[model samples]
Target: MLLTIEDLTKTFPGTVALDGVCFDLRAGEVHALLGENGAGKSTLVKCLTGVHARDSGTIWLEGKEISPASTLEAQEAGIGTVYQEVNLLPNLTVAENLTFGRQPTRFGMVSGRKMRAEAEAMLAGYGLDHVNVTRELGTYSVAVQQIVAIARAVALSGKVLILDEPTASLDARETETLFQVVRGLRERGLGIVFISHFLDQVFEISDRLTVLRNGRHITTADTAGMDRLELIHHMLGHELEEAEGRRRHRQGGVERLQVRGLARRGKIEPFDLTVREGEVIGLAGLLGSGRTETADVLFGRTPPDRGDATDADGPIDLRTPRTAIAAGFGYAPEDRKTDGVIADLSVRENIALALQARRGWTKPIPRAEQRRLANDYIRRLDIRTPGAEKAVGDLSGGNQQKVVLARWLAMNPRFLILDEPTRGIDVGAHAEILKLIGELTAQGMSILLISSEFDELIAASDRVIVVRDRRHVSELVGEEIETGRIIDAIAAHENGEGAMTP
Candidate 1:
């Protein structure tokens, strides 16, 4: 084994972030660390990299007991980490950023020529010669930046490389390129720890899998013997009997919201979809399959090239989020930390933010009234915070998500677009969120739900729309919306074949 972690434990103020987690990584293996948000996956990674010292654990690197007290120590000991956010300096050229601390110098002077040459050579090894090493790193797209980060980490000569959601912002072609690089790394005998929400990518690349739930080690097994549903069940901590029971109630009603010829150039293709008034509609596809893109168009994040939405009220022109809001549309974006919540603001301020924005900043809602509204939501949604005065950032991941939902719930929208609403939350929180969606739909609200979890999409949505290659390729309703069918449709489209529709 390249690395072994035994009985690792970590605790924060009110939470046990990691509890006796054990795992092993082998050379020439891609091990996927799977879990929902706040499930100790992050803690495990931090512990491995020395970002957070573990409370108790035994870490053996190449059969030698080592406790790295800092990230630099971990790096020197041949352990590297590439986080979700790009850590390279934006102002510096790619070459300089890659060799930031350990620059090749001669006679106490940095060798720019050597740096550029080495950087270019390293990038070329990963099929990234198209990106100029001398150019500013920020000028390139996120995919290119990610590649640079990975290249830098590998160039550190690390025996184990930890990639945390490296492909979250990457497109289809970019993800393919990354997979190739990962395969190459595995071939070179590097133990890679892949962390991602995209299960298909996890299955495609990972040789072994370790699942964490609520800061506890759940299971570790070979990827080849495990199925998608089983992996999800492990991550969710759902009993087989409970899942079977839920599966029986999957089928629901007719179309509530209908979209025809929905198109957005360079975003999504002309698509058709429908969701019943009392039903949840799921958009399932790969990273750039236009799932979130379609949600953007529907919820007025972006203007569609040419498309129309028909609801009980009538056909509506959703040109912008303001117009969509006025037409009774609500949107909860994917990244709650960035797009959904205001970290600096109090819970009251954050919860009333959307309503206040819709009302226009000039005509502000009275502070007293805003407090009242916030308090009501806090009570209704069971938002866990000290008080309405607490900063939104101070709350737990699940609680912060609740505040985001409360913001939209205050709008009383007819149609709600939830883009990865349950992402980065625990199983209990996910269940609560899903239950809330079901409750809203039962009360005559139409919803467009998008999730990376196939089972979550299938379980919560009454109908499913599969997008592939930035286009809506298939629609499955009622009995047709099964995991196997959805996976088949997505795989078919991904491999250059059109999705089979029903």
Candidate 2:
């Protein structure tokens, strides 16, 4: 092993972020760090990068113990990291960026000619020699910028490279180009840490993988031997629960929401759906499969180019957020930090936000009423908070998510859409949120649920709607609902075959 970590542990206030995590990286292999959100993946990376001090651990590089007090020290010790977002100066030329602050100098002046010549040579090793080194980095695509960033990292610190979600913003062609560059680096014997949520890419690129759960390492093994299901099982710490009996769960009689040809070009293909009261429609798909797009269109976050939505009163506008709210629709978005929660606001304010929007701004809910509603739901939803005045951002991830749920539930929506509702929260909170969904549906509220976990989806949904490539493929109900069936529906290249339509 070129780099080894033994019994690494880190703790923060009220939580153990990492405990006895052990991992090793070989010189010429790609080691993937795999885990769901808040599974200590970030904490371990921070520890290695010296962003946080480890409580107890031993890190050895080439059989010598070295503790990096800061990122600069880590870079000096041959550890380099490239995050999802490119950090290089886009306005500068590729050559200038690669040699930033340390440009070749002659007679006490920077020499562009010297810098370009060296930078061109360095980028050549990363399969980017054809790119004009003198051109502004922004002139090229994001994929090109990433290659330039990697080249600069190797030029400064050559031993190890950490690629964090490198393909997130890339297209298939761009991802292939980046993968080629990574392969070249591996051939040259530099240990590479590949971190990504895309399981397909992990199996395609990583030589070995280490699964982390709840701040502890589960296992590390060669990628060739493990299938996607097995890898997910290891990361989730169990196999998905069988959905044998729940397929017969009956939907309420009243039709709550009706959609016909709802879609935006290049976002989602035209699709039709009917949500009866008390029904949970689970959207099953991999990332980029238009799950979020459907939710956005329904909630009026993105107005569809073409669609018709209706309630019992007949046609209603699906044109804006205000209309969606007026029509008794609520949404809890996937990225709670950005789209869902008002972090700076107090818990009471966050919970009262949707209601305020529903009721015109001039007619403010009284402070006494606000306090009572916030306190009532806080107790009802089990949101851990000191008081209604406490900042929602100060609470734990689970509590923040609960606050978002409380906001929608307070509005008493007829239809609710929850995208990745259980994400980034602890197991206990996840269960509570699921249970909350069950309670809501029991009260005859229609729900559109999106989750990566198949077990939860199968367990909660009356019918599973499968989407792929921005199109609805199939729908499953009754005895057809199961993890295996949903996986097949998601994986089925063409629609209809092996896909149960209702």
Candidate 3:
């Protein structure tokens, strides 16, 4: 084994983050660390990189016991970590960022020429020749910056590399490039620890997989022997019987929100859609297919250049989120941590935020009322937290998402737009949230759902609107919401072969 982790245990104040988790990595193999957001995957990575010392464990590197006490020590021992968020200095040039600490100086003077030559060679090796090494790293796209970060790590001659969701923001083409780089690294005998939410890519690149659920080791299996459903089942710890019994509702009733000739310059085209109460309308397409953009336009985050939304009351103009909310519309943005949650606020404060905003901050909800509302949502959504007083940031990713959802639900909006609300959450939490959506619709709420998971869209959505290249292409109604149909619609839209449809 290139690396062995035995009996690894880590605990926070009141939570056992990891429980006797064991894993092994071998040279020339791409080992995937599969788990839900709070399933101890991050904790295990932190422990291995010495960001958090394990409570109890034996970590062996190259057949010798090695317990790194600090991140620097781990790096010195041939371990490199690339986090989900790029960690390079934005202001520095690519060359400087690459060789910041290990720069080679001639006669005690910084050697710019030597650094540029080395950086250029590194970029060429990674199939990235267009980016200028002399330019500031931030001047390049996120994909290029990610490549530079990877090159810097590999240049350190690290025997093991841990990549945490490196392709989260990358498109398909960029992801293909990343896979090639990873494959080259594996061929060079570097053990890679890959973590991703994209299951298809995981199967494409991973040689072996180790799954974790609820902070415990679940199983380790060969990627070749596992199908997508089998992998999902293992991660969720559900039998085939339970998987088959998941019931999803269908669309019912007349249109509640109607958008006519919706257009956003350079973002989304003039498209029309009708969303009905007691139904889930899914927006389907690949990345950059204008799905999220449509959500933004509907929520008034990105105002439409030309459009009108109507109810039985007739056409209403939504120029801003405040207007949208006042008109009984609520939106749960895609990035919960950045756009949804208020990190410093307590759970009670976060849950009551939207309601408080609607009533003006000066007219604060009474302490008793706030606590009651918070407790109600906490119990209703099954959000795990110590109490209402706990900071929203202190909770797990899934819980944070629940807090965001509660913030919107507290307002009791007529139209709810959820943009990948369950992304990066656990299977149990995902099912719970999906079921909650169904329950809400049954109670007569209208929903516009956007998700990258095609299967999820097909299952939960009553109708799907497919978009491509900032234009609405086609609408998939009842009995036509299959994966193949969705893909074909997207393709037709991209090729400009379909008439704009609602």
Candidate 4:
């Protein structure tokens, strides 16, 4: 093994991010670190990269016990990390970004000519020789920027390279390009740690798999023999039997919202959808499969170029989020941190946000009413907080998610859009969110659910719509909504014969 972590542990004030987690990486191989959010993947990565100090653990790099107190120290000790968002300066030229800190110097001045040559040679080893080293990095595509980031990391740390969600923003062709580079790096005897939510990508590139759940190491095994369903069970820590029991059988009422030819160019293809009263319509797909895009269009975050939608109030033009809200629609975005919650505000303030917005700024929701709403939701959703005045940022990931849901629910919208609502939360919180979904649906609240977890969708959805390459390819209703069928639909090709190569 080129790198090994034994009994690694780290903790915060109220949470143990990692507990006795062990991992190893062999040279010339790709090791995939798999886990859901709050599964200790990030914590482990941070500890390894010297971002966080481990409470207690032993890290061996090439048979030498090492303790790196900073990222620079880790890099110097032969470890490098390239994040999803490239850390390189976008305004600088590619060569400058690569050789920013360690630029070649001559006669007490930076040597631009030598720096550019070094960058060119570095990129050439990764088959990125075509990229002009002198061009501004921001001008190029995200895939190229990623390659540049990888090149820099490799130059700094020759042994271990950690790629965190490297292909999240990349397209199909771009992903293939990045994979070719990664394969070459592996062939060169570099130990690459691959972290991503895309299972297809994992199975394609990984030599070994390590799963973590709730900050504990579950298992480490070869990727070749591992079944997809089995891997999911490890990450989620539950059997298919329990997930099956979550399958709901609610009878939908009259059509609440009907959409026809809704689309945004380059985002999602024109699609038709119908969400009825008291129904949970699930959008299932791989990451970047237009699941979030569909939600955005439905919520009027990105208004459709050409589409017709009608509700009980007749034809409704969803030009913006405000219009959507007026139409009795509420959306809980996939990323709660940036888009959903105002972490700086109190729990009470956060819960009352949507209602206050709908009521207009001039007409404030009275303090008493705000208190009542917050108290009601805190008790109803079981949000673990000392008081409504507490800052939402101080809460756990699961509680923060509940606060976002509470904010939207206070508006009592007829339609709700939940995108990855149970993600990153603990098992207990995950079940609570699912139960809440069922209860909300029972009360005639139409929901458009988007989840990467197929079992969750299978359990909660009355109907499942499969999205592929930003297009709605198939829809499964009634008994058709099962794990096998959903996976088949996702892996199936355009002609419906076999799996998609990507």
| Best of the candidates, TM-score | 3
lDDT of 4 by residue, 164-201 (tens): 87875665578888999999999999999998767788
CA-RMSD of model 4: 6.0
Q: Can you write out model 2's per-residue Cα lDDT over 253-353, one digit (the tens) per residue? A: 78877899898888888888999999889998877788999888888899999979888999988789889888889888876756778889999999998
**Candidate 1: count of backbone clashes, pairs at least 3 residues apart or interchain:** 4
lDDT of 1 by residue, 245-287 (tens): 2322334455556778777889877777666566677888877
Superposed Cα deviation of residue 175, candidate 4 (Å):
5.6
TM-score of each: 0.72, 0.66, 0.87, 0.71
In terms of lDDT, model 4 sits at: 0.85
User: Residue 305 error for model 2, in Å?
Assistant: 3.4
**CA-lDDT, candidates in order:** 0.80, 0.82, 0.83, 0.85
Per-model clash counts, in order, read 4, 0, 0, 0
lDDT of 2: 0.82
Worst 10 residues of 4 by lDDT: 493-502
Give the runs in model 1 whose Cα sits over 4 Å from its true position: 4-9, 19-24, 53-60, 63-69, 89-93, 104-113, 129-144, 167-177, 196-213, 217-276, 279-294, 303-320, 344-352, 355-406, 422-436, 451-502
Return the TM-score for candidate 4, rounded to 2 decimals. 0.71
* Maximum-lDDT candidate: 4
Error of 4 at 130 (Å): 6.6
* Clash tally for model 2: 0
Candidate 4 residue pairs in clash (backbone atoms < 3 Å)? none
